[model samples]
Target: MRRIRRMLVPAFAMALVFPAVLPAQAAPIRATVKSIEFEGMAAPASVKEMADQYSTASLKVTYSDGSVKTFPLSYNRLFKTTDSIGGTVAGVAIDHKGAPIIDNSVPANPTPYVSDSPDSNSLFQVPGMAPSALGGNALSLVTHYEYITFDNANQSAYGLIPASMSLTTLDQNKQTGELKPTELNKIDFSGVNGLWIPCNGSLSPWNTHLGSEEYDPDARAYEADPKATFISPFVQAYYQDKTKTGNPYDYGYIVEVKANADKSTQVAKHYSMGRFSHELTKIAPDGKTALFGDDGGNTMLFLYVADKAQDLSSGTLYAAKWVQKSAANGGSADLQWIKLGHGTDAELKVLVDKGLRFSDIFETSDKAAEGFTAIKTYPSGKIEYLKVKPGMEKAAAFLESRRYGAMLGATSEFNKMEGVTINEKDRKAYVAMSYVEKAMEKDAKGADPADDIQVDKISSGVTYELDLAGGAKDRDGSAIDSAYVPTFMSGLVVGEDLAKADALGNKAAVDKVANPDNLSYSESLRTLFIGEDSGMHVNNYLWAYNVDTHKLSRIMSVPAGAEATGLQFVEDLNGFSYIMSNFQHPGDELLLPDPLKIEVLAEINKSFENRKAGGVGYISGLPSMKQIVEAAPVIGDDNPTDKSLVDLRAKAAAAGAKLEWHGKNKDIVVTLGKHSLTTRVDSSTATIDGKKVNLPAATQFSKGKTYFSAAIWDQFIKL
Candidate 1:
């Protein structure tokens, strides 16, 4: 008989309606005339746009108050190199002072070509330079992070853009027999292996940038040539026992960088937090608890509780287990947290120092039969045990966390769990799952046989909200209970017939959202911003969803072959908000239209050829909250004299509040937070929290939507 797992949906009634039913021809959401628009700023041009048609002028933003401001947004090309502080090319030459020399006159040597060599021009070429083993074109690619600072004294804003140097190699000049050094771009951070494929990151409460290293140290490549001295020492030392298999274990961890512009930035790799294909980290309001999402199939969601507030160097790591309580795909589940153990770097290093191999912690078949203690039972009914070998437990738990978690009964069954955002006020976290693959769907079904799991065949993506409130807590208010119910928000879906087109044309059946990968929430805007990283859209977009109004709007989009990433909202001292985002790998051939007319393809390819500078970083301004409210649509009956009450009901629903209408008493009551507001129709006053407060407009009602002044609506809701 097959074992059945039980599933549950937490807070099922409050689930947001999925946008899958939206019409394909729905108009793009836009701001009305009352909202401010940035003039002279041209909309993003498609690959088909002519070179001359591109706009290069600074964006002129016109605020609702008629104040005009200009933001000079442009790409910063400076990045650190071994010989220089700044350079345009991947390889740079420095002057005597160690500053980058912007000289293009160096004679190009064509003889004895080293460009094809994977190990050429690496950092190892020069002794005493930054120690890095990365090689090839990986060294040339520079990923950047943008930092903004506001000065209250001058009422001005400043920006700091630092580029993370990709992997590098040492190349020998055959003609001169001299070694060429390929250095890193940003080096203010000390004691860290250079970043490779620096993916999405978050700003910590201590005001620092935490970047993730995605897909590092190809194990097979290292195994193919184990004698290479350029291999990272961490990889070489950590996997000494597994060198034959080439399973290097040093890569895939979070790197923290200081965000202070006034001081030199410091960098540290939090290896104790566990290594995996890290997507991003969202720290809770308490500053000690953090939620980490991994970006790969069969991965796991990790939780870390720091030893102290605002410090991530030491922590306890745990893997999540989803106890099925319901059958709905992307629905809620009773979350169980399985402890994988904890330790500081100093404590864990003792085990590493003891020469314990990573594979030693696992009980072999021969050893398992010898009666080792069982750690946990796997889904396949296999029993895992802690190896009897001394000093192996802590090392394996820290170095191979995913495996250790599995031994401890934690589920590692997620499919590309990407970005995560936290709402401090609500104590909820929204996690983005890029796709519901076949295996995850299977796990959901097999987890519970009592209910049927409804999973879409052509899965797009989903955003799940995990409730962190009212859980079993410890002394410090950290949740010790593993049971958490997550509400699912289906923002993108693909139908069967349109699946092929959606894949080839990179278009979604409904344009509201597709393949959401990165998310950020702004309390001031009362909106959640979603950035797409997918091939299911012709041009990936950054959408803003007003949680209060339940309105979705496309605020920005990228060119073909590009996905919007690294979304951050920064408010200046003057109360103006700007969105900082990056466009990764644009103008790729794969982004072209499939089965298009030959002429159209020719035109598009020609345009793309001339504009193939793929990646770019941008900072765009936003409209004020009043402007957004003014742009919102108002509904009422056609009757001229019929007064309408503002649709407080809709607002209540969006805010997750309760609304009570007293028809006979001609009054409406709204309950939110610890306060209750009661008002009568055609009244200019309302009682809030049992105290009379002035209302912006008289309450009115109509056959259609209830109508009220925007001022009154703002007063009643947090928005």
Candidate 2:
């Protein structure tokens, strides 16, 4: 075989490829990055958690040519400010007059009270996001921010939101996919009685931000008296209706904000999806199916199926029934969904406008009585017994959803199930069991009617994965309308609970996820980004877990006492990829012991303006191939490829293709890959291997040099 191969190549062509006499050089193989990997960030020691913690971010970039290289990666914080919407820091907050709202009420600690930024940004899949009217890169966006006043001296925050969900266009460097906030304008929520406490949100399949309102006001309170103190916030600050009426039905639903090219937005609170303390709403890979976990205790796993794709205005809501499979590892369950009811958002708005009370849908009693069916349910995980009124099942399903779900025997064992995300390639979904305690553990933390989930109370928490399938049925054995439904769920990543506190007063293992809250999964990278909202750790961390490798790496540590929030991993935004992260309410972890808080509070407070702002930022090292490529070609882009060997020789070296002297006839051989060209330096024609080809220009012999004008120079690339 060796002799046979040696005979194939004109032996002369192998030697003197780049002689000392020639200025041109024979090319060697080039290396380009093919993959990247990182190591976990170190846990902060003691008070170091009070400051931002970045891991020793080292990158392993593997190239296509099988070469390897390493580099140090760093976090490029986009912005972190308590500054009001007059500038671009985070998502802005605007008021009724469409001007930035400067809520400097708390003179000691002042910052923009920015809520949830969507999981996906405006730069994502820009071609699909581009409005047909604005077919190019140019587009406009307006923003509105809802704000709360933090009275730091009093150690309490004002709960009332002056405005609702803010909408704004992000300024992005189209080439790099860098997002910068600009201006903000309030989205008038008078149609929905003003937006509630807009919390962590997700980006919809149709490019909309699906936001949440944590801790819905108790409808029963409003049922007893329409002038409840909780109702005053909206009436006084938002509606300004001195009449003093707040409709409980109007708040606590999934809010969608759709941006348009004209800088206008269409916003709606989807009542059909059921009202609960929504943590975050994640749309399934199938687009129409939506899944979310209620943020409070004794809650139920919720799923919403839209009648049409990319439409959330109307849908059928379902609650999960947990059939326990194990009592270990955060527990496993075969999930059976119970169909609740269906309705249109528009229709629900009509009912909300009518000011429907809880009493209108169900009759309640302190104890079990005639015609009153008692069921262990909620005032948020504790227990409330109620009966459904006749002919109000549908209304009860939407307006008083959790109550109706409990009455129907849905698993009310889930407590503080925070974020839901999916890995499309594996057909699996993940839910963050922020705290593996209370209702999830049998009789633990005094959770009653503990029928299902029974696991050890691990304060460090666990992230669970659900096996998804296309065809699914409810507890009644009725067909579910959509694909993307979870059939079974098991713990994917569980944190370690320590019996004693660490040096940093950490109750959970420092290297593991403590009170895992915000989660974002990148399908392309096969990684799940987990954020912490814990009292277990002195400082919350953001972690990256690779599904294939089963490697967990701590990528970042937010300020002490701050909740790691706004976690979004974008696989591709134009030409780059980014791991988005944010922290809120720094120096506000009331969960820690007073002593620990006292030690760290002052330092964490100093991290921001008067120590108020939690940050809004992202990791910056990851970039796609398109992002890393050169602006110009790797070879001769300035001169046409159809040039003489003299002109092509210079580019040949850059392209990593060989230029060789061949044969006794003074022919030259240019080899790129498997193909090569052979021609006399003084001939006007050439032969690609053995095929004859004509040259556009005649070859010439200059002083001490030979040139061949071959239009076929470009053909070498194609070959």
Top candidate, metric lDDT: 2
* Index of the highest-TM-score prediction: 2
TM-score of 1: 0.58
Which residue window of length 10 is worst by lDDT in model 1?
1-10
lDDT of 1 by residue, 1-719 (tens): 00011000011111111232234343322212221222223334443531111223233333222334453433221221122322333322222222332222234521110000010011111222333233221112123322111122222111111124332233323322122334334333324423433457777776656777554343323444644312343232222322522234544577776522222346777777876667777777677777876776556767777888888888887777666555354655766666666778666545444544434555444334554544322112233444535656666666667656665656666666777877666667777776655445654534421122244433566666677743554323455533222222332222122435643365455455666777887765455667776666656666666555444555566555555665765543122345555554344334444444233345534543322222233343343444333343321111223333457778878888898888888778887765466777777666654445445567777775555555444534531
In lDDT terms, how accurate is model 1?
0.47
**CA displacement after TM-score superposition, residue 110 of candidate 2 (Å):** 12
Instruction: Write model 2 residue lDDT over 1-719, tens digit each, in one string.
Output: 00000000001111112222212233321223345456565776666555664555554544443344554446655455454444444444444443444445578666444432222222233233443221323333322232343533333333354545544445556655556555544566665566666656777777777777666777887677655536665555454345666677878888777766555667788899998877768998677899996776677888899988888889899999899888788989899999998888888777778878888888777765786655555444445657787888988888878888878878877767888888887889999988777678887455364467787777678899999887798988899987789999998898998898865577888888888888888765567888887877777888888776667888787777667766777655656667677666566543356676676676665666545554555677676534433221222222344655555565467668898775666777777776566667557666654455556665565665556553355534533
Error of 2 at 618 (Å): 2.0
RMSD of each: 15.8, 11.6
* TM-score for all models, in order of appearance: 0.58, 0.77
Relative to the true structure, candidate 2 reaches a TM of: 0.77
Q: Looking at model 2, which ten-residue stretch has the lowest summed lDDT?
A: 1-10
